[model samples]
Target: MSPAASKRQADLLKQEGNAFFQKERISAAIDAYTGAITLCPNVAVYWTNRALCYKKRNEWTKVEEDCRTAIQLENHSVKAHYMLGLALVNRQKLSEGIKALEKSLELGRGAHPASYMVEAIWQQLSKAKYIEWESLSRERATQLRKLKVACKEAICNYNSLGNPAADAPEEQLNELEEVFKKAAKTDTPTEVPDHLCCKITLDIFRDPVITPSGITYERAALFGHLHMVGKFDPVTREALEPHQLVPNLAIKEAVDSFLSEHGWAYKIR
Candidate 1:
């Protein structure tokens, strides 16, 4: 096929995909996007659109892959990054997801602040000194609900069913709300003590800026949290450890690898 004909076909597929998406026909939309990608794989938008469709369809893995491809084709694509971030966030890949969303913001999409929703929940509630978690925005509350449930699931999967916090019973979720009020912010505040319950206090899961200091970005973030509300648990503490936790290491490495692979300069220190 001629280049012009391929471009025209790709455009048509994209248009049909958009129309189907607007009608809430996720599968059809995906099919159209797939067609577009097949016709002109060079255009990042085709992959990006398909990513969104997969996201709406709850095809989280596909969403991540498509968005990653889109970003590779157009590194400045805020929408693509945002969509990828949401997919990761929903899958509880909080560290990596937040990193993508933050990149989207840096690329000029502030309204896409939805990336920070999860951390914000536990952080903010901790700051208020009350457990009025039900008052969160609908979407945010839903994410938290999911997070709570996921924590519960994790605990159950690990055979630690007795820990009510991990299980997140209503009373426990509510009771934990008060920690936010007394939290502090620090770039390197201490990690959560092994015996203490883990949680974010104060709605400040805001990303911490990493400079030339010996601290990792996540450590800086933990410190920022400490400065804001002075509270944390095992979950937050893993960031600064010499051998960062699995999820944190994965994300930190992903960013560095992504940048390095693309010939962009970034340093951990």
Candidate 2:
């Protein structure tokens, strides 16, 4: 068959796959997509379609494999990255999954800023980040506890030996104690950056939205303020409406990156 004939056949097969997928015939959809992939091996969409079918069947490993191939064929394929992220998460590779999801969101936002798919990807990324933060927080707490115990033990041993010449120095022991003291000082609130915080709530932004006046606010707080007060910007006090609010993805991403590095900040509420 000519190259053009092969391309036409592949397109038809992909259409068949889409029809099967719409009817919830996942196995049939996978088969159709596989046929398209076989004919047009370079087509990223065929591989992504197959990956979607695998995802529906909870076949995460296959989804991962297909998505990886699609990404290799077209690195900017948002669907490929999104499916790969979910597959990796289901396969117990949360960190890699989160990265893939982040890339998908970045690409989706750039290519389709107002696309509904961008919001869906953002929601998944949010959930993934939360899970990662939760796990890391518990792990770090356990490690801190162990370190404090070790520090106490070292101090006690030095004291019992009456400061033997070979014992750890008093300076080292003091520093270790100081480290735990600071670590245990959970009462000291994490200092969130001014730009990442809402002016109205004075708290770190969870869901940031931008007003028409070019000011950002926490979504819930802004909504509450508008309901209780009036249709005006809290900071500017200019005429504002709910429809004028837009998601502040840049600030939200910055907050997410900061929280990822400083899991302690997640407790700031």
Q: Which candidate's lDDT is highest?
A: 2
**Can you write out model 2's per-residue Cα lDDT over 1-269, one digit (the tens) per residue?**
89899999999999999999999998898899999988889999999999999988899999999999999999999999999999988887999999999899889867865456776787788778777766766777788989888877867776788856655566777788788778755423367778988898787776689987799997767777888899899888898888888999999899978775665334333
Q: Alpha-carbon error at 87 in model 1, in Å?
A: 1.3
Instruction: Output the lDDT of residue 96, model 1.
Output: 73
Candidate 1 all-Cα RMSD: 17.4
The sequence of per-residue lDDT tens digits that candidate 1 reaches over residues 111-134 is 332244334432322322111211
Clashes of each: 27, 0
For candidate 1, what is the lDDT? 0.57
Q: After superposition, how far is residue 12 of candidate 1 from its true place, in Å?
A: 0.6
Between which residue pairs do clashes occur in model 2? none
TM-scores of all models? 0.44, 0.69
